[model samples]
Target: MRLDASAGGPSGAGLPARLVWLCVALAAGVAAIALGTATWALAQSPGPAPTTVGLALVCAAVASIAITAGAAACVHRLARAHVRTKASASAGQPVAGQQVEVYVGLARRLQGLVHREIQLLDVLEAQVEDPDLLKGLFQVDHLATRIRRYAENLAVVGGAVPRRQWSRPLPLVEVLRSAIAEVEQYARVRVVPPVEGTVRGHAGADVVHLLAELVENATAFAPPHTEVTVRARRVALGVAVEVDDRGLGMPHPEQDRVNALLADPGRVDVGDLLRDGRIGAWVVSALARRHGITVKLQSNVYGGLQAVVILPTPLLGDRPPARPPATEPGRMPSRGEPTGTATASSSMAGASPSPVGARHHPPAPPALTRAASPATAPAFRDAVASGQAPRDAGAAGPLLPRRTRQAHLAAPLTRGGPGPVNQPAGDHDPTLMADFLRGASSGSGEPPAVRAVPRH
Candidate 1:
């Protein structure tokens, strides 16, 4: 496990022998000084015989040992003081980081509230169809998205997860446009033909944020009269998103620093953010590192910036045919684009109706309890007759929870269904469930009362 294993072996064994010689030289220096002092004392003595000279020599040796020990002690003390100073200086950094942490916590809390509001807005957008209202909601959504982005920067730097997930793979083009939408000058930006594909759900957030940062830099630094262009290409290792601008490119040193950070963003410390002039770059680098992505910044031919982001194969999903758009530089999809998905049944031709649909209708599940008209009652009747359990317990896959499948079956049937089933402890008899559905579906057994309780 040790790379220096050979350093302790035969080859390197004597490499440290010079240390022994150095110690010997130190000892000789001490002895020589002692001898000199002994000679001086012998010369100064009034009457020095052999015994007195020998006694002087002994005193000199003692003095030399004391002096050598004192020197070693002083060396150790100086070393200890230097170490303490360095440690103290390093300790102060965490105190400053703690202050930043307070703000980071506050920022994340605020982000959570804003994110909740964003979720509500998403629900509203889905439920409402009025164009005027949609436009206002759309703008509000954009504003919230920006707020969330800044919040995410704080959270990520503070070492926290941002908003909730996108739940499923998102259209790659849509995610790219969403990133562009957050830019200040989105209108001037153009997206060339992109590889029609989808991005994995969890990676969607990072990819979007990363692209947004690059696109923001492109549009923000570019000349006001020029447009920023986004392009994509399929590469051998992965897919690359390229943002091109005609603005002044970065100086060599800054580009190198940015590239270094992007190459290994773990080297970035949150405490160092204050000294950084480019928080956008920091965020991009950190997020890219988080997602195992590679981002490279290159100077374009026209002395502009080109940021190429390479995403690995795992992040890509359901890649359709590689085709360029008929219209180059296509704008983001407008509000007129349909929000709904077309189902196979909806697309089928020559559909004839029975009670609910064609002569053949899939039997309703056994769990539904909703009241039905006499014509529709037959489906429920068939359901009672069939008494079928869910075929694939988790047929919904990752989209919906297993418990929600029961709601998809039983709860929606009743006019005033037992809203959410508050099941009692240890009873899951399928027959009991079916009976309960039937009871809830049917009107009360008592006859209707004819009297009006109150006349205003």
Candidate 2:
């Protein structure tokens, strides 16, 4: 459509009036020169004045038309060249490269910051025992992951290779999970059990980025509360991952156009895609091209678009074989050795049963050389909740029952001094509360009933 609109040059309907005036002036100049030359020739030839005048007028008219045609052609050709140059510039080869460089630098810095933030969040989540606090930390970590993903995409678009690489091939299931974790609506994404396979260490990051873009798009465009299903399987060529969503599918023309863009993303204008709000597709294409991965979109049986990405054989790696348990050389099996089942059964049979209503307790934490510090409360609570040993040396003391902060409050109660009964009923009475707690802990003296005071 843009091509058709720009086909006409200065001579077309949209031509500026000034160009027409310039052509007219040139033609008039040519006509005047032709008339003067004709008059001079007539004077030299000694012909009839009327006939010479008539011939000169005819010559002038012919010269004007010829000059006008030549000038118009030249103007049209120049106009066309100018338009082509402008179009090429607007398509974003030079300008886009500069912008991409700037963006790539910023993205790299952002990635570093987000990476550190994620590490902090992980530590906090591990140390915090409250379920609510842990949930909030998880949310923050997820957002950080998303930010890192955007930074990585920007770097990829700028032709920057990923700095981090896995030392060994990662399982296909884990890759998909990592991708899914970056999406905003990841909870709605349902991943089918993938066949056993591993992605090559070099290409795993790109593959994860590619799949993340696809899954994000699916989750964004799918109907609210609908699940976006992702499936992976091994194919003859390599491994294929499919993302299906129940969104409104595009028309055949739009699909073809997008497919063509993905097929040869280099030919498409990055600026144009950015303007059209299709940067996701461009990012996916760029990543796929980098790793020799193939991405295609087609209509699925469910009347939605299905994006299928094929990781070529070079990007796929075989799962390493499981290593056998290390054993002493030349060691023979003993007949007295009990199998796993027999050992478990014997242990269970020899264990004594507990009495009814008795509370079960975890194994005692290892004793600390010194008492627990006040700061160790959080770590101690986390370990106790998880049923694990105290992580801190000072946290071991918290595992055993002890009263550290109530000694001052309970001193007067233990001394059996007379209660301050003359104090106002409306005022807070700490002595009565402390006495109640002391009696409860000691399981001896009856707790004194205190009158309830109403708030104003």
lDDT of 2 by residue, 1-456 (tens): 000110123433224533543554454444455455444544565433344434544554554444334322332333233333346677864433443454456446545655555555454455545565456446555655665676566566667788668644466776888899977789999888633456766777778878988888887777877889999864445568999988886678777767777899656554454444465676677788888788998888878789999876456543211111112222111111111123333222112111100001111111221122222233234434533332222212233443222223343342343433321111112333433443343233232222122123
How far residue 51's Cα lies from its native spot in candidate 1, in Å, is 99
Return the lDDT, model 1, position 40: 52
TM-score of candidate 1 relative to the true fold: 0.47
TM-score, cand. 2: 0.50
Report lDDT (CA) for all predictions.
0.49, 0.52
Off by over 4 Å in 1: 1-101, 119-139, 266-273, 318-456
Report the number of the highest-lDDT candidate: 2
Reference-based TM-score of each model? 0.47, 0.50
314 in model 1: Cα distance from truth in Å?
2.5
The clash number for model 1 is 6
Best by TM-score: 2
